[model samples]
Target: MSEIWFRTGEATVFASEGQATDAMPEVVIGSVKGPVGTAFASMLGQTVGHTRMFILRDCNQQVRPAAIMTSKATITNSAYVGLLGGVVQAALADAIVDAVANGVIPKDIVNDIAMIVTVWLDPRTAKDENLDQKELYKNNYEAMTTALTRAMNQEPTIDELIANRKTIRHYSLEGLDIE
Candidate 1:
């Protein structure tokens, strides 16, 4: 493969359907020309909870940037695994297809580029039977679209970051005393 450009982006979609279904995906978009690609190729090995797998548009096709997705959250229940591998995976894969079609990812480099997205999925999602499956799909779909779009566009420019630094804090730190 010939050397090509690289871009990275991260975005979170949360507090939508429910806390259990929030999606935070950090995407690395680049060719096998660098470290990110190396990481992508190597992520197939599974640990206990994080089962790395290629996101497929169907049984035969993997979404381009040739995306790979895995959850960081430790999953203890079989039900959680079902949701993570089922609806959530389908949602994220669809978003990736849209990204390529929408020009958020260059169509030409679909073969050359690869993506490895670190996804954060709260494992409690399976405990509640009444949780809306459609909402969960929508939440993750939005997250992947936002992340890929921002990656290709290089969003939140340095100026934006500096301007928001004082007002915007990590959500977990919302009630903290730090300044």
Candidate 2:
């Protein structure tokens, strides 16, 4: 209904719910005629241990915005493949559709916009039978929605970044001092 406000967006969200089942999604959204589209089309050729695939909400239904998903880790194990292509995939697709429904991703550009999501699904989850599939789903869903919202809004705006620059420590540097 309104003028298109977002031409390109990208963000990464890490959601922690399950150990080894923490979800991290790095998302890029843009027009099909842009670079995101080029990467989306070209990623189809990657068929190593892990391959790229479309994000589907169900057996025959892909999400409206038309998204592709790739793995951050090389998927060598069949079990890991199943988890990624199954639960994680569904989580992401649902998140995208809900984003549209909730106005995080505008409904007007569903056809023109394409999403490329690079997901990290921990390898440990595949080997651990006790790990809950629901937890995995919830984790990814939270991550996907948060990532999409952040990207679409161009979040961590200049002021937000400037204010929090010194307060937030890089996750990787948990214990080391500034010295």
Global CA lDDT computed for model 1: 0.81
Clashes of 2: 0
Global lDDT scores for all candidate models: 0.81, 0.82
lDDT over C-alpha atoms for residue 56 of model 1: 78
Report the poorest 10 consecutive residues by lDDT, candidate 2.
1-10
Number of the top-ranking candidate, with lDDT as the measure: 2
* TM-score: model 2 vs. ground truth: 0.90
Q: List residue ranges in candidate 1 displaced over 4 A.
A: 1-5, 17-19
lDDT of 2 by residue, 1-179 (tens): 22333344443444354457788888888877777777778887777876688999888999978899989898878899899999999999999999999999889888887888889888788888688888789888988888888888887688998898899877888898872
Candidate 1, residue 120: the lDDT equals 77
